[model samples]
Target: MKEAIMIDLDGFYLEPVLVSIGAYGITPIYEKPEPPESEEADEAPELPEPILIGYRVAVPVPSGLFKPRYDLTTWKAALSAYDDAMDAYCAALAAYDPDSEDEPSQPPLQVDLRAFWIEGLTRQEIDNIRNAPSPKTDQQEIARLEQQSTISMLAITELFEMMLPIIMPEE
Candidate 1:
């Protein structure tokens, strides 16, 4: 069965009066207004009506639907873990060799994170890395750095396990 859906639009140059079924196509329709009558000969010409020349539309699509969907805890953990891993990985790279003739390429995590919003790490931490701050210590600080890396790695592993088979057939 098919359903007819109606949407009201505002602030448009052309309005959609009717849309075709199935394909859902619409054409622009504009209303013409009568000229204003002038009482005084010195009256200024009526301002041109704002033309409906162009329009923009936004559509939202659901990512997916699943049984036993991810809850708050799962989402939070995955986000935190991803962020933590990114932080540790970037930190390790930064401490490797800052002044060396060969500069290391930035990881996909860091490059993508800067473009999009994600959880984990404070704004200061992200900024510190983004701004190219000097590495405070050398490779000797491996233990402390390794601890964070370990935690991030384990967290990511747990997240992957949760995603392995997200849903099962109803028993």
Candidate 2:
């Protein structure tokens, strides 16, 4: 069976994001092998039908646990799969209702979405807001973020150029 999938920017950047069994990949086993008939005919049990639900993602983890592999099973990471998802879910909630000062109606993300979802954002959200109806508060917020992002990027680029040597490559 085929399913529609979305590729959103979660800062994976060409790296695999470790996903839980149900949360990520799941190869389907259509049928199980038949059981043995007589006392000795060896045969495997019948299997259940399943579908590869999602992508097999890997989470880039800090080095240390069990010989420094690039992935982690713990939830310690700020951008851990579950945490990242929760953050997005929270953002959706916030965007839906930014007025509630009551502690976010959800837990504060270990890290802010504003930082991670920007480029994935920067340009898209601007028009999205303008096209939205009413006072369009969310749209306005997106516009402000867009400007702040541009300024921030320019300042950073300038700082880097001034602080470091600029070398032009020979043709």
Candidate 3:
């Protein structure tokens, strides 16, 4: 009777029916006795300990999440700047008179709050923020600013989530 033994090559596992065949640069280990089957058929089967072959190099998995370029302190400063910009913007808008016949000496600067907190913004995100149309009315502008604030908060949250693995890794 032939017995199968599991082999681990890098991170992949391979099981072979015959153990007589030998390959260069490979090591085969005999598996331990199988555990007794449980009464529950739905339970997962126990896998045998894999025989390791060749040197195993650690490969980092891609998170696919945005990595913040700035540290926490810089991000905090950016958030503060964003808040100040929003306040100044809202105040200016509140005092604006749409029906006024005389034009104001100086118009408020249309600053994008995202500019202040662009720690994790991609090129596309930055372009979208920069290319967004200016709101025709003060009310619309305020709404737009509020929406941007929400996006900023979500970005911050994503940044925190991305950092979690580094902060506390699994055992």
Candidate 4:
């Protein structure tokens, strides 16, 4: 005779919250359109929704699923397993910044995802691991991304780090 088998793995994990901004400020050079004859000139466009999604960001796999079948290892066999739900969790996060650019020509405040892992894994290591879907990325690229995601309203240093050279207008 045979018996049934089931298992459960539970744990709390931190998700990345992308606080994003455009890399290069997009500038539009549109000429002012002709105004209506009777309507006011400076009336602003009426917006219906207060919030909008600017972009979709992909989330990195968590350390929980980093290895396969940890319980089967020689270490311990108390039926304890890594948080298996993280796969689905990460999948849901895959479409992080799924919003279209409002003005492709102008810089916009973008909503991006940055995972704050409950575990101690750093952004660099997570970026390097190769997965079935995407190829491996180097640490520098990961670092570059880290810099891009560090946009904070309270951090003035972030602006200075962007330090783009300015060209004086021709006399």
Task: Pick the lDDT winner.
Answer: 3
Quality of model 3 by C-alpha lDDT: 0.51
- For each of the candidates, the C-alpha root-mean-square deviation to the true structure, in angstroms, is 29.9, 23.9, 37.0, 30.8
lDDT of 2 at 111: 43
Q: Write model 4 residue lDDT over 52-141, tens digit each, in one string.
A: 212122333344654322121221222122233444445555645558544223222222222222333455665667433664479878
Task: For candidate 2, write residues 1-171 as lDDT tens digits.
Answer: 223122222322232333453443222223334543555447554554443332222323332222222121232354566667787877777676556665444555454322222133334565676577866598889999999999999999999887665564346
Worst 10 residues of 1 by lDDT: 59-68
Model 1, span 1-171: residue lDDT tens? 232222223322222233334432122234456667778889876855754433221211123211111122443455578788888778879787867887675653422211221233456766766798566676747877998999999999999878767755345
Which ranking of candidates, highest TM-score first? 1, 3, 2, 4
lDDT against the true structure, per candidate, is: 0.46, 0.44, 0.51, 0.35
Query: What's model 2's overall lDDT?
Result: 0.44
| Count of backbone clashes, every candidate in sequence | 1, 10, 0, 14
Deviating ranges (above 4 Å) for candidate 1? 1-70, 99-105, 108-171
The all-Cα superposition gives candidate 3 an RMSD in Å to the true structure of 37.0
| TM-score of decoy 3 | 0.21
Q: How well does each candidate superpose onto the true structure, as a TM-score?
A: 0.22, 0.18, 0.21, 0.14
